[model samples]
Target: MSASVGGAVYAALAYLAWGLFPLYFKQIAQVPALEVILHRTLWSMVFVMAVLLVLRRWAWLGEVLRQPRLLARFGLSALLLSCNWLVYVWAVQQGQVLDASLGYFINPLVNVALGYLVLKERPRRLQWLAVGLAAVGVLWLALQTGHIPWVALVLALSFGFYGLMRKMASLGALEGLALETLLLAPLAAVALGLMSWQGRGALAQGEPGTIAWLLFAGPLTAIPLLLFAAGARRIQMTTLGLLQYISPSLQFMLGVWLYHEPMSGSRLAGFAFIWAALAVYSLDGLWQSRLRG
Candidate 1:
């Protein structure tokens, strides 16, 4: 297959994996979110470190450290990423996987807005229309639910910022994630220690099987990320933007069909509007990219 096709397939697999992640995270329902976050952070670090060594990226670490500005930027990305992880884990454990899915659905729009604001890259008229439609959907959902889905908002915002920072830093996938995990490791270690000292350690009390599954958390986090990185390098940002929908689509299906999350009429209407917006945006992106070609 062509590189573009190959990249698209990898992206699809990565996102599909991410879409089903709620299923995995929910399995460890017995553990506290914080402890789960800690395991995720620690194990992810171990996995990325191995990848880094195999890729001979240990030298890159020294280079990244020597550049204070890059290190600071990566550190900020890590902070945003940590927030995203914590909130997502909390949302899944609290039975708000659907809401988390909404966050991912809304994330692309947020990225568009961020692109305009942060990158000063103006969207075309169709892109603007897409943004407006998404906004209407979000507002309508809030009105019908009588509550803002703040968890979703937090997820979108944190992830959007993380993406923006990573784009700016221009670090490779494994390299960047290694730095991010390293940046967060000390704090996670402290939190884990505190939990242990307080005798509230969530990891200590889980069944051996449960804990063993938790070990998968690291690979679970890193693998899709690594896939995304590889795919990102080969595809245009616009293509990546469109591919993001694949994950949320799966999550939405899982929520409504399998998990039986409530789907009110208003919720359906709101999602329809958002879908319309995404359709416009995707078409516009493809059309414009074609024109450029």
Candidate 2:
């Protein structure tokens, strides 16, 4: 019970940090999203590598590098992860935090479908219903807006695929993230160097405050993941699934109340459907877990 409480605290803090990510990204909104992502990749690599070195966690990395197959797999996961980060940062910069929030709200359902399609794992009847309801919510929003919610869809799908890849990965969260950053770091370094040479980079041209914020991306990207890894090991899957909603919930509130994004009656109705879907999904999972125990 004590372990569970501690895990809940860790998970909550992790989600809170993720929820507050928009505020951090907003501070660096002046930087091009691509450049921001490049810095994120580079700084994240440096920070995570430092941690791995301190922990003497170099063996798996060497073993992974030896296997061409593992490298290829991690390379693909890295690509997906990078794309997800780029899209998310772009969305926040575009004042589409609401859309980004919706994407995460839809993500668990996407994960359910991926499990069914990719892993041949069947979702229960209530889970299918939950997915169907989320689809309706998305469709309603798209129809009301008279445009595809491309931002939300891209965020959901990219992250869903990234999660699927990681689920199949052999490495722990820290190690896998380290490998992904290492794979992308070289290209990210080149991009940053070119931007600096052109005198167009935030690092070289921006205010000292801005530079500090950009550097903060290192811990901002990593600490929550570390917290999440710790919490996931200690908690039940059902508990973790419920905690996962906290980030998007905070984002949604920030978008609506803080950022004053448009939340029309139609939009609210659409979100209601998605929220209901999540309730059903969570409840069903709890029920199943209770049955197993």
RMSD of 1: 2.3
lDDT tens digits, residue span 60-133, model 2? 87788899998899899889878888999999999999999988877776777777788787778987888788
- State each model's C-alpha RMSD to the native: 2.3, 2.6
- Model 1 off-target regions past 4 Å? 1-10, 197-199, 233-237, 286-293
What C-alpha lDDT do the candidate models reach, one value each? 0.82, 0.84
Each model's total of backbone clashes: 0, 0
lDDT of 1 by residue, 1-293 (tens): 87887878877888899899878987888887878888888889988898877878676777778888888888888888888989998988887878888898888787778777887767789988988998888888888889997988999899877766666667787888888899888888788778767776665555788878878888899898778777766664446667888888888998888888888887899999989988998899789869978
Per-residue lDDT of 285 in model 2: 77
Please give each candidate's TM-score: 0.90, 0.90
| lDDT for predicted candidate 2 compared with the true structure | 0.84
CA lDDT, candidate 1, residue 87: 92
